[model samples]
Target: MSKSIELKKKAAEIRIRLMQMIHKAKAGHTGGSLSNTDILTVLYYHTMRHNPMEPKWNERDRFIASKGHSVESLWCILADLGYFPSSELDTFSQFGTRLIGHPNNKVDGIEMNTGALGHGLPISVGMALAAKRYDNDYRVFCLMGDGEQAEGSVWEAAMAGSHYKLDNLVGIIDRNGLQISGSTEDVMGLDPLDKKWEAFGWHVVSIDGNDIDALIETFDKVPSVEGKPTLIIANTVKGKGVSFAENAINWHHRVPSEEELALAVQELQAQIESLDSKEEPCHE
Candidate 1:
């Protein structure tokens, strides 16, 4: 099977796993997690060079989940990658479980504790700057929600990233449009967001966040310029893959009922089967 096809299948499986985790926990940022699954899948599986066994390896690339509410997808990916026991997923959000609703630094493979809006980019900037100061080659990746753009700290970090010329820093915005309330534009106008980033002196690129192939291609060539931070505005559906939840604001943090979970899984399983069938046979 081709790498793209394999990643596509893996993304579908990740969506299914995240949905199951949310359903079981009865609390999660459903829409956002679903939207960002493809981006995280591409990063963990293909882009970032990190060892699951060595969670604190100094040379490994770091990822900060800036939009920390949507952490179900990340937890599932971490477990499946052997950073922790896959069985630990069942205790997500339960009493005493390290797998909380948000990304926790206590967990293996997690760089920092994040839940409050607008803090991730700043921390990521520090990590990236530290790398440059120490002459290390590690990169820092921060994933933020488009809604989180309203946070002033993000822009501050943006300016700092450029001023320091932290080309090793990559910031990705999950531009799903909808947030906890409603449309981001209605909440806080972020039109011409790309232009604003450019004005801050960072290289920006916009692409389909749900397209695995596009994600792979884009991540492979980072810091496209020699002395600027890279920002990827990943346009994605609010609830991708699942038919009923797509673009539905209620699904932002709403727990899926038993019936809804069943239907969502059915749709995702069909996607996995479709990708499996598309694999070309190998010949000697």
Candidate 2:
């Protein structure tokens, strides 16, 4: 199979694992995790420079899941990549398990403690600036939620990233449209997302976040301009892949019933089967 096809397979499997994690643990940000699964897949499996065995390698690219609530998918990805024992997955969300609801640095591959939405981008800026100061080539990737755009700190960090000309920092916002309370537009208007980023001195690229092929191509074009940070607004469905969950806001923190879980698994199974049936080139 081609590399894109392999990554597609990984994405499907990760979604399955995410669903299983939530279903078993009885806790997780289901919809958001589902929405960002493709982005995470491309970053971990195709893009980014890092070794699972040497996760702390100095030169390796840094990835921070700023919208850390959706980290169930990230946890699954890290385990599959061998950053930690896959067996550790069983303890997820349990009272004593290291795997809690949010992303914590305690996790082998996780770089920061994230869950409170707005702090991720700021932290990423600091990391990127540090890299620039040390004259390192590593790039920092920070994934934020569109709902997180309401945070003032995000914009502050955006300005800092640009002022420092941190071409090494890439900001990816999971513009899935929906958030916990309701639609992002309903909660807080972010209609002029692209223009606002541009005003903040960022080079912006908008893409279909759900499409694996599109995701790969856009990521390949990061830091689209020199002397500026890149912001990719990935338009995605809140709950992708699962019929009942797609665009359904309640799925944000809701758990699926056994029957629902079976159906979700079945749908993703079909996707994996179809991708397995053929090898196709990725880039256009």
Candidate 3:
């Protein structure tokens, strides 16, 4: 299969797994997970150097899902990447299941158990610092929600990353605009977000988070500036790829009804077909 076709397939699978997990759990941050699916797909399937068989491989890259509420996306990607069996996704939120609302380090591929708004960036910074000190070439990637950027700890980590010149770390913000309550601007204005990161001495790039081409190119063009961490402010829609759910705050942590789930699955499948049609035909 062509690389584009493979990525499209991976994205479709990720979306299916995410919807299935959330529907079974009857509880999850569906909107945010959907919004960040493409980004996570690029990281796990295309960008990051990780080994499912040896998840604890010391030299492997680390990914921190800082906006832990949206962990269904991470769980889906982890399962797809062989961190765990796809069947385990059905156990999400069930009694004795390790697949809780937030990621847990005890989970095979999870580096840190993060659900709190601002914790992942700091933890990722620490990982990056450790890697640098040990002369390891591994990289650290952290994904934070735009709303989570309101947390003070995120800024603290930003300062530390810049001060230490931890170029090995990269932070991707899901700037999807909406939070649980309302739009992020109304909750807390992050206007001039790129400027803020730039002023913090980090390299900043902005892109359409849902665009596969942009995601692929951005990940390929990492280490934005040597000696400084790179932050990609990925502009996204809250409930991406689903018309009714898109930009709807109600889906933030709401369980989808059976009808809704069915429709969502159909829509996602259609999207996959559309992507397939757009791909250039492979020569025999």
- Judged by TM-score, which candidate is best? 1
Instruction: Please give the distance, in angstroms, between residue 70's alpha carbon in candidate 1 and its true position after superposition.
Output: 0.3
Scored against the true structure, residue 191 in model 3 reaches a CA lDDT of 90
Give me the overall lDDT of model 2. 0.92
Candidate with more favorable, higher lDDT: 2 or 3 = 2
Which of the numbered candidates is closest to the native, going by highest lDDT? 1
Please give, for residues 231-276, the per-residue lDDT of candidate 3 as tens digits.
Answer: 9999998888778889999989888888988998898899788777
Residue 209, model 3: Cα distance from true site in angstroms: 0.6
RMSD of each: 1.4, 2.7, 1.6
**Which 10 successive residues of model 3 have the least lDDT summed?**
1-10
User: Against the unseen true structure, what C-alpha lDDT does each candidate score?
Assistant: 0.94, 0.92, 0.89
Q: Name the 10 consecutive residues with the lowest summed lDDT in model 2.
A: 275-284
Q: Write the per-residue lDDT of candidate 1 for residues 2-118, one digit (tens) a residue.
A: 889888888889889888888898889899999999999999999999999888899999999999999999999999999999889889899999999999999889999998999
